[model samples]
Target: MFADGLFILFTVFAVVGAAGLVLFKHPMNGAMSFVVTLIALAGLYALLNAKLIFAIQLIVYAGAIMSLIIFIIMFLNIQEEDLPAEEGRFKYLIGGVIVVAPVGMLLTKAVNSLPGSEATIAGAGFGGVKEVGVKLFTEWLLPFEIVSILLLVSLVGAVVLAGKRGTNK
Candidate 1:
């Protein structure tokens, strides 16, 4: 019962954070909201007994990634005048909701169709760092390496673009 209550609380936090992320006009506010969502997701991972994922979520996403995002936002120093007028934003939001409503209903139906069972604790060593590391290094090595390379390339590209912008100024 306690776990279920915590889950509900975390879920609500995540949803509210996500909404704030989308609804907030300022980039800094949106980024802060995303951090809240990330932390809530980490809590959900903890509830699921995914210790490795939970730690990674907090350390990598909520900590490192959010810091980087906030730093970039600060570096950009966006002003109100820099923002584009959003006269049609409400129309876009309503259209987006209309498009997504059917997909949300489908997801709800699919989840309801699943067989209900009592929650079971995972066996010992489940979600352990060693276990995950072994699997990630062995079975998922290629994809992992590919992702690392992609991230590196993107980082380099961002640096180059930022340098260009600085030079132009």
Candidate 2:
């Protein structure tokens, strides 16, 4: 009962966080909302006994990635005057709603039509840290290393671009 309640609470938090992330005008506010979403997702993972995923969500995404983003934002020293003024923001929002609503309804309908599973419980060692570690280091190793390299390249590129911009000024 308590777990179910927490699950619902976390779900609500996740949805609200996601909405806030998209709706907030300020980039910092959006980033903070994204952090909230990540944390809520970690809670959901915990509820499902996915401890490894929960930890990675918290440490890697919420902690390291968000910190890096915030640092870049600060380093850029963006001001309100630097942002381009938007015309008819309301019209854009309405258009977004129009495009999203039908897609949302279609997804809901498709999910509802899927056959229900009989298993209520996860099988033994499901989402266990050891199993996940083994799989990550073995089968998923190439993609994992590729992603790391990509992130490193992106970081270096950001630094180089920022340096060039600073020197140009």
Point to the candidate with the largest lDDT: 1
lDDT of 1 at 160: 96
| Residue lDDT tens for model 2, 10-129 | 999999999898777778888899889999999999988898899999999999999999997888888887755766767888899999999999999999999997538876887889
lDDT of 1 by residue, 1-169 (tens): 8999999999999999999998888889999999999999999999888999999999999999899999988999999888778878888998999999999999999999999977876889999899999999999999999999999999999889777865746
Q: 153 in model 1: Cα distance from truth in Å?
A: 2.4
Worst lDDT 10-window in candidate 2: 81-90
| Residue 66 Cα positional deviation in candidate 1, in Å, after optimal superposition | 1.4
> What TM-score do all the candidates reach, one by one?
0.90, 0.84
Candidate 1, superposed: residue stretches over 4 Å from native: 165-169
Alpha-carbon RMSD of each model: 2.1, 2.5
